[model samples]
Target: MTSKITLFQHGTGAMIVPGLFDGTIDIQELLTHGDTGIGSGDGLDGESIINNGTPLLIRGDGSVTIADDHFTVPFVNAHFAAYSTINNIQINDFQSLGNYIFKHHQYQNILFSVKLHGQFEWVKTRSVFKQSKPYPSLVATAKSEKRFESQHLSGTVIAYYYPDAFSKFAVGGFHAHFISDDQSIGGHLMNFSGFNGDLGIQKFKKLDLELPIDNADYLNHDFKNDDIEAAINQAERES
Candidate 1:
């Protein structure tokens, strides 16, 4: 029998929408769930990309650095599985990539992971500045985010696809992050002009979600009062 692929998640996007930026799950413990994934640091410090076993922190200034093992993460999606390489195709932009995946993959209701590696004609990204006590909602934080763009950059794009049914727990659609080959630039991917590379995809049959059961903020927050869908659409998508 074939083994089922599992997607391990540390926290929910819903929690972040309400500004629950503190997390008890450390990078050291998160890595054990999967060697490859994407997430953010405590207080929304930066965008995190876990390529293989290395966790990289992309700061608001578009600076990239290795994340400390002790650094805590408020939200993360990770999985351990080998990707099946799809034929190289011309990707004009981020939307095109999404269309391609939807048209070819035929797993709309399922969760999957995508990895693209090669040269990009141009790439656009953004990262949130670290927040302090009495954190602001993600939508508010995104308004003051730092945006970066580069031309002819070589790097990898790590992303996850969570169907609409999973929106309450995670981003409803494609949520992606980028990292250059030299590890100099990367963040929450806003868009890309051109992509010439290999596409690899893996579909997960099961989801292993770990919530912050002991977190007062998570337990106390009244999520029903918030427009989670609207907030996520505004804060996470290209504006």
Candidate 2:
């Protein structure tokens, strides 16, 4: 059975969200805590894995706060939470991830901003899905706000140039939620694209990415340069 695994680990991570250009692949098989994940054996050392493609999640209600000093030195507090749905499903991968790079865009006028620090967690369960199994949340809880309209820079189409083979991409956690206190509203595209969904109830229907979400606007073009991917990978290894 394909089950969703909740990955949660509270270790001191690098402060700044490092940049992963592309082609940057690191195959480090981590030795997870023997006590965590499904089919528990030893004691719960606080970890677990359900499957390969587990549910990536990120959700919360209220300003999330934490302190960390790792990764990107001087970037302080590695925290973030971005949320969004995909294929009628919401992904929370970044929920437990620390420090995320966020970009904001303007439609009417070509403008942008950026946010660095980020944090996240996942909703334990929705009232309707009460019987649902819980997943490990790297970070949950979103800044208090009504999700009807704009959830930070969410809803707005933030595009990115993924590797050529990307049939589709997913970016969850708060980069999808809009909790970056450092976000400036315009900047560079990050390593990924936040989750896309139909939250707007206009036209009385869910806003699917396949359908038009906004007016004629700036186009987000993907630079299919293998060199870009190669550069990203080279940088990661050297760093």
Candidate 3:
């Protein structure tokens, strides 16, 4: 099995600074890299969830739809998932799911991509609106983010776990997105509970970074401030 994860554009920290919503890469090109992944749509319009090589969008109104062919992404992490094993597990909530993965996946230092397939008792998610020119910082956008929740849901959990060393690249801890089996609702997964699913795990041995060269805002922006990191953490965890 191949071991690699391809990242589109800059790290998450850099994105929070300039808040570049207009993506530099097209979805057609992004699909060439992997079959499963998560990202934000053009103008940060919606949550981008790629399953089976198809890009689906979860808009701010909690609406799930297919992305336009020409849509772009500023950031994304994807890979051809070749699972070592698919374990049937009973997870009561987000914390329990983490504990289970940690116990089963002993390699805490490598990158991990997971797919949880099954029924969920309840789930909560959030998605940010598209930002325009003179875009506010990610911290500001996060403050007025939209949130959605559901009960007795069935879907696939598209998630990734990155090591601490790569926290700036993406959230270091577990980050996930969900799209219901019926494709009606889902977003950046926040809290979930009562799930019985097949947990598919992929360990990546290599990482490929694709930086944005054309975006002048991203290229010349400063990402040295300490508050940026805190904002990212707060936005992801608390929003």
In model 3, state the lDDT of residue 205.
Answer: 67
Candidate 3, after superposition: displacement of residue 147 in Å?
A: 0.9
Give a tens-digit lDDT track for model 2, residues 1-239.
Answer: 11112122221111001211111111111112111111110111111121122211112222222211111111001111122322332334332122222221112121111122222221111100001112111111111111221122432222211122321121211122222223222111122234333221101011111111221210222234223333323322111
* Count: clashes, candidate 3: 0
Q: Give the Cα error of residue 68 in candidate 3, in Å.
A: 2.1
**What are the runs in model 3 whose C-alpha is more than 4 Å off?**
1-11
Model 1: runs farther than 4 Å from truth? 1-4
| Preferred candidate (lDDT higher): 1 or 3 | 1
- lDDT for each of the candidates? 0.89, 0.19, 0.77
lDDT of 3 at 132: 86
Q: Put down candidate 1 lDDT per residue, 205-239, tens digits, no spaces.
A: 88898999999989899888888888989999887
* lDDT (Cα) of model 3: 0.77
- TM-score of every model versus the real structure: 0.96, 0.18, 0.92
Candidate 3's TM-score reads 0.92
lDDT, candidate 1, at 201:
90
